[model samples]
Target: MKGPVSALGINLLGNNVEAAQTVIWTHPKKTEDIGYNFTTTKTITREELNKISKYIDDKDTSANVLAGIATTILTTPLKPYLSISSGIGVTLLTSYRSTNGKLVSDKLKKSTAKSFKVKIAYKYRQTGSNDGYYFIDTIKIS
Candidate 1:
């Protein structure tokens, strides 16, 4: 028997056929935003720090400061039982104090970095009482 003249001839004799084209379909991806956490470093100039210190000192005597103090007093009694919220109240009260501002300014004044890391947490709405939205859960500076 003679060998096939060509591969194309062999394919033709076998009645074999090949696809001439191909098609594909794709869809866009969807994303859901539930929550996120991130850390960012912020630089503060001496002038800015001084201004911030002054602002805090001024606010220290404001009604909000009194409210914070009252909140602390009311929450301290429940601190042992409800540590989370009570601790938050105490932290808020301390944050509104000139002493805290002085301490922070002094500490940063001695350092060359003059920068702080801010940790921010965000949360999405949970229930039907309100529309879905994002809000900051907490901001911690170090």
Candidate 2:
């Protein structure tokens, strides 16, 4: 059994499908201010893990770290945001992306010593796949 410390944290971060379609979708100059939402202290199920493993297996590669996983309703021109929102108490940074090109991943830098204020960026999916979402690199508390 996994301990409470091992529970998976999932954050929706942000959904910008509408924003990106309009002229108001101003790209952030810093890449950190893109509209994103966040969540922490989540639990990952075995089925989810299996799915992830299969995805990796199909790619013939292995990964030791992942931010999070999400799904969307569209296949193209979709932008999803995933972030920890603040850098408070972040200790490490690791990232991995699905080879299928359906997942967007990010990791914080090891130098992250403060809570994340909020990181924003556009998440584009595969050319013809309907996978859109940003996974958190880590969990941060303010």
Candidate 3:
């Protein structure tokens, strides 16, 4: 397997291997058959979102335009925690509204308790002989 790392990035609960897809690899002879090797890596890690969230949330007000999306796909705990580590320039969007409407950008700046929907997008690249990075997003507050 001298190709890309083919790593798995996941937000887990407790330390159960069956709980999340941490890493998967294709069977040697069965090139097309993929299998998850939970025996190698098994640990549910947490993520840092205070800075990232505030940054993105704030961008919702400005012209920077947040790039990632919140997801209901993986559930951990209420304000559990989030961890994300991937190739540079990964798109992260967690906004209340789709990129639509003309309700005025300035108004978005001075608003509080702005509920947002979840959207997740990323840009990956396999440059040189380096393997791409993995990311895990969790909620850790409450």
Candidate 4:
């Protein structure tokens, strides 16, 4: 009987291998998700008014005190663009009203002690890539 001629009998090949398939997943974007606009109200207190008056009379050039007050009173996702300006504006408006006899000061002579409410409207404005800031749309005091 004749058999296959081989010094060492071993199979060199078997089956072919398949390559892996890649799949990527992503979420859909909505128009509303891109930005937001809203309005909020805050009531001013006598103590806050006193602080603003003190800061104004002291002529705080850095506006840090005003910024702090703005951050607390204004409603925004992050630091508002007009935080410092808003604080100073409100203080000046209150002072003007007091001077013009529109708003009367309390015993402590604090114009802001009149206990007025502020209504603020904010709109998100985009500046750079995926970056934005909230800008004041309107502000009303009553």
What TM value does model 1 have?
0.31
The sequence of per-residue lDDT tens digits that candidate 1 reaches over residues 14-132 is 56764211111111110031222222233445544444344354454445544443243323432332222433443433443422343244665466665444333333333243223
- For model 2, the superposed segments whose C-alpha errors exceed 4 Å read 1-26, 29-42, 60-69, 72-142
Tell me the spans in candidate 1 whose CA falls farther than 4 Å from its real position: 1-41, 50-53, 56-106, 109-112
Query: What is residue 95's positional error in candidate 3, in angstroms?
Result: 19
Question: Model 2's lDDT to the true fold?
Answer: 0.27
Superposed by TM-score, candidate 3 places the C-alpha of residue 88 at a distance from the truth, in angstroms, of 12
RMSD after CA superposition, every candidate: 27.3, 16.7, 15.5, 26.7
Q: Which predicted model would earn the best TM-score?
A: 4
Q: Which ten residues in a row have the lowest lDDT in candidate 2?
A: 85-94
Question: Taking the candidates one at a time, how many backbone clashes does each contain?
Answer: 0, 13, 26, 0
lDDT of each: 0.34, 0.27, 0.28, 0.42
lDDT of 4 at 25: 12
Please, what are the lDDT tens digits per residue for candidate 2 over residues 1-142? 1110111223454763221111111223312444343333323444443444344333423232222322211111123322221111111111222212322123422223333222213232221232233333432211
